[model samples]
Target: MSEQSVRRPTQKSRLARYLIPIGSMAAALSLIAIIYLGYDLAKGRISPCEAVFQESSIGLKTKISFLKTEGELEIGREQLAELTERAQMTALNLKTCCTVLDAGRVDPEQFLQCKGSARSYEARLDDIAALVRTAVKEGMSTGSVATTAATAAPTPPAHVEEQIAQEVEAAKAVSRDFNKQVVQVRKEQALETLQATPPQNVTIGAQEREPNSDLLTTNGLSLDTWVTAAIGDGKDSDYFVFTTPKTYRDRIRVELQNRSTTLEPRLRLYDASKASLGDRYNTTTGADLSYDFVAAPDTTYIVRASNYYGESAGVYLLRVTPTKAYDAYEPNDDILTAKPIELGSDLAAGIMDGHDQDHYRVETGDAEAQLLVTLTNSSTSLRPQIRLFDASKASLGEQHNTTGGGDSSYLFKAAPNTAYYIQVRDYYGDAAGTYTLTVNEAQPGG
Candidate 1:
């Protein structure tokens, strides 16, 4: 008995004697408390750190996955979705690494041993995954990290194959295949903009002129005045009567009966000595043609035109004029003491108040024959005027203007006794034609 006596409790090891029982009992209670307290913890749901850790884990796995499938056909979009989802799952695990620490559930010192194991194998060394792996490896338990990872896994991103395909198609529409289609489209648009954007619209400051040519030999003394051909090449030795006062102020505008035609014209100037003034013209173009030279007082110029040059033949008008003009005269002639003039009917010369037109009859050379019209002084706003001419449409002078008087006389010494037609027009002017026109032959001074 003495011997058997207590070999008695040969001093049991610490846990076998008292600590084990106490620990086992306490563990059950601890489990319940841990679950409840974990539920109550401020950080039980997620430590944003887990996101970083999850990203790192899945990131390494994804990178490894991509490497494993290298040189394969483009990854089917479906497979890519699966891989991304896995990455998001792993990313969630990292969320708990720090929160467990914050909640005192993890002793950072004890977790340090597992730090390396927790690291995510990301090819990129960004601190995110590296940090989570470090925190987990520091002895962070697998259960702690894994639970958070599972919960934090991002929901699979919505499959967007249709949307992606549409976006791709839209991008390719402008560049089908390998060609850059925008180049041509852009170039064409630029060209159209340039052409349609309207020109600078210069108001013709200094006129253009052509100074020298070896064609015409005549000092423009007079026109050939040929009935031989109303619309043909002009006389080789004839002249024109257009002049330019200063080289800087000369321009000759030309228009063929149609733009499809061309012409070569010559102009020569002469002094009182009948000597050539050393100026001339000769050209061929479908548009306005001009001659330039400093003009002298007693000099005369000319325009000898021909349907010459590379173009079609059409009726064209060639005008001859001096750049500087003479003062204008009013319309005047007395039909007062005279005859029964029918109004509205065509007259030898008078204002046709109805159509707002004017009439003029010219004698051969009397540029002085004119209509003397007197109008009331009024606002100079709309100074509409009308003048009439012969078959050539030479300006006989304004047959109707709002400035002249009621007893206005329209006299024409230009055509002493020729039957002329007058259509007075242009009535919108602020001034009214108060006085009616009186027609009488202008007293002529030979």
Candidate 2:
């Protein structure tokens, strides 16, 4: 349109043109701003705490993935699976905490909880890393050994092989040291957690009752309970006494968990007569002490806890538990201490360890009797073996099963009024298990 014919452009038209474009531009800027704010908020940028938590959660997830891949290749499958499960659980917890914080919930308790979870996750990662490192180093050493053994034509010099062995040993030592450090850190963390929150399902006993340095004034402890106490100073000792259960044979475990960084725990066990049964001490700093024994029925036992160096003063937790119930006859590991068994009796017992041997004494009547002794394996790993011995501790005959979880029998003529011994053990001294030994008169002309 011609300017003259249309006359000068109206101010309204000019304003309309500029305002329409400006309005459109303003709307576009608003939309962009909204998207930016939403993205920033979603990424947990609302607060410093939320930001830190979000960062931590992402970092933990990444670390866990790496650990899972590395652990599967290096560590045992079961161990790796367990670690992975724990890591996943921890990651879920961290993510939940981060979400809560991101939602602008300012709860001090929740914040503390998240902090604790973070610490736990870090500790777990450290432990997994240590395990993987150890496994990798061990694998390397094994591969080196195999290579050295297989190389024949291009054999390395003796000194070179020796040097390789030395290097492998050094690597092992480093791995061991790293593992120890990780163990110490975990122990310290566990102690802290325990102190912060006492365990459930446990009767919290009293603190150290002074003058518990002797049997007469010792503190009494209960089974499946925790006792929190402290050592005052050098030469300070804490004594606890408990009665064994009335069960025929009880496996008792005494544990001492150190609570202070400066304290190294030492545990000593004793009987009712104040005779020292045994002792255990922590070999590393911040390690726990544990001692186990098979106690006689309805007997009193004493446990003494003291600092390893008898110097540093700190807090500790002591607990006693009956771990297992053994058969009526135990401590009969040799012919001299053989338990007496009656004829036509079947007895159940266990080989407590690979090196354990059970002995039983059988007495014959006034007439010659043919005895049929049968040993039946009760554990899948045990290959039963039976040995007959005269009263003079001389072996008469022996029979054993060729395979595990099998039975063995022996037939012999018993003299009148004579004491004979029956010994039982694992065919190979490497498996521990339970078995039943039966003694009966053999049928004649059947």
Off by over 4 Å in 1: 1-384, 391-395, 399-412, 427-435, 442-446
What's the lDDT for all of these models? 0.37, 0.72
Clashing pairs for model 2 are none
Task: Give residue 176's lDDT in candidate 2 (0 to 100).
Answer: 41
Candidate 2, which segments miss by more than 4 Å at Cα?
Answer: 1-204, 328-348, 353-371, 376-408, 413-433, 436-446
How do all models score by TM-score?
A: 0.19, 0.38
Q: In model 1, what lDDT does residue 144 have?
A: 51
- The sequence of per-residue lDDT tens digits that candidate 2 reaches over residues 84-121 is 55544454545554444443254455546555655655
**Using lDDT as the measure, which candidate wins?**
2
lDDT of 1 by residue, 325-404 (tens): 21111122211112233323223322223222333332333443543333222233324454544444445565444444
